[model samples]
Target: MEGHIVLKNVQKSFGPKQVLRGLSVSVKKGRSLVVIGGSGTGKSVMLKCILGIIRPDAGEIRVGGESCIGLKGKDRDAFLARFGMLFQGAALFDSLTVWENVAFGLIQGRGMARHAARDIAVEKLSQVGLSSDVAALYPAELSGGMQKRVGLARAIAADPEIIFFDEPTTGLDPIMADVINNLIVDCVKRLGATTISITHDMASARKIADDIAMIHKGQIIWQGEANKVNVSGNAYVDQFIHGRADGPIQMDVLKA
Candidate 1:
């Protein structure tokens, strides 16, 4: 598929445990794919593999038809320049001011002048509904929602071709989470970037996803358009979306 990021038969392992097993999925160009799954289902591992943070032990990962595995030095840096990520905790730098944090990649990675980078950062912050004054504040000075907004702004600061959002709405109140979800949808629409987001929040998924895929035990069990997730009929999908305790999907937790 044109402009698609495709993963085929990818696998990864840690110690005696296997994390990803033959995981495969395609995220079409300029569309959002939200992955849903229980904890320990290898969703994060799969995302890392795609981002080149964690290399897969086997199989293929292609970004726009070019294989991305084992990339090095300038190649890896250039490849990474195509991506922006919003981490689960917002993951802002406590020491840097908001705008500096937003411009980190442009300044450090691309060697852009600080003045130029700061202007771009301020612009991106405005896109996320933050004012220029907020740019001067440090991450620790902001509330959770504000911090997430800064994270979102930073993610789009470089206008990346692909963006990854890891549990974007986690750690926020319901209203704040919804606000963040709306911003995410709006930002992605404006950027027209291909995105892959992983979250347990079904409401966020419904609001932001074009396609939804479910991961279980390091494998994709079901995949379809966002609207069709309700009717997926897969036991695990149904259980997860409804958040039911008694279902085919059992917890791996050891009972006390």
Candidate 2:
């Protein structure tokens, strides 16, 4: 219950460009919510706002009944400690070895000793199907799928109460994407963590999401049970899921 996230009437802007226009959504504790949208739909912005990486122009962000806006110093650090993020493209540090990257948060954030942190890191890597031998290698040495797995290992190394997955399946073959999806489901189920994942991959969404929300022009156009998405009935949802070019949702393609 403490991991529930609520964002009410959230709005964000950059100068004349308003991004999130009264966006509101919520996810219950221990549930997975996947947000799907085309680029520049404020999906990533919303995550940044929730993480305090970007403060909203106006609105409320409450996590587990506590206000999260304008968090400072130790409060911000503490808030972040509760959440893990698997960034788009894996976002691994090239300078650090796989095991070191996984243990970075444990060693730096929580001040755990390197030996103990590495033990947990290796275990987390194993959970993600990476062998201990692979842990000594660098991100550059690993395949795209392997890098994603290492990023996942880092995310869960701390056993966070909540996880934010930013395009978790990006840059992987369909088969490998499904593998990552299965691992995500397994990991989330094991931790019972509240999860918010933003992805354009419907396969990944349908696999890992309990519920799905669609954001367009900075607001949630639709939100519902994943199983019922095909029948959501909304025009935008219909256009999106069907990947139809002709629908209520229009794409601004350049004239050729």
Candidate 3:
């Protein structure tokens, strides 16, 4: 059985501005792949394309040996049911309590009983080291780190076959960031899910990725094992990982 997710010659554009240009990558079953790139480099666009939130102008995307581009109606719902996402800002509902937020997919999307969904929500919260008490509070009541953990719990509530993490460690203190990273590794290992994450945070990437691919100006310029990123010998990768300003990668900043 082939369970690998593959993308080939993918392209997307918004009118005149092309976002993805023949971007290709693959992740094996039960492996973690992280995409690193600067802002507006189409990392999110590539992810959205895979999620079917955005349709690609061209190319192929295969998940578990089936095409996943431009799915509709029941097909789209079924395809989306196989994946989970943790957004960059937690993206929780301010009105809903934590448990309600976590169980939203189950009760709403799957039509599961609220009681059953709540139980699963509590269980997932435990997986991320959050207590049942925390599940009673709204998103606004929690600290930034706690809110992120809630997002993670909600992500795994459905026990998805594939999970996508978008900038998981952004905006947290270093210690909290490490905490989230450890939780992500533990949870993913326990579930044995194939994962795709988009971020420029090398620390989080190093902690979570089996493979790392760098995107630049709508293309994957370099890719390799996470352990070998330091010695990739590509100047762009070198400049990025080291956080250097004086490198081949130029920012589109206006003169101040």
Q: What overall lDDT goes with each candidate model?
A: 0.94, 0.95, 0.93
Shift of residue 216 alpha carbon in model 3, Å: 0.4
Which has the better lDDT: candidate 1, or candidate 3?
A: 1
Looking at model 1, residue 93 earns an lDDT score of 92
Across residues 80-159, which tens digit of lDDT does each residue of candidate 1 receive? 99999999999999989999999999999999999999999999999988999999999989999999999999999999
Candidate 2 vs candidate 3: the TM-score winner is 2
Instruction: For candidate 3, write residues 1-256 as lDDT tens digits.
Output: 5438999999999999999999988889999999999999999899899999899999999999999997999999999999989999999999999999999999999999999999999999998988999988999999999999999998999999999999999999999999999999998998899999998889999999999999999999998889999999999999999999889999977987
Predicted model with the maximum TM-score:
2
RMSD, one per candidate, in order: 1.1, 1.2, 1.3
lDDT-better candidate, 1 vs 2: 2
| Candidate 1 RMSD to the correct structure | 1.1
Worst 10 residues of 2 by lDDT: 1-10
Ranking by TM-score: 2, 1, 3
TM-score of each: 0.97, 0.98, 0.97
Name the regions of candidate 3 deviating beyond 4 angstroms.
Answer: 1-3
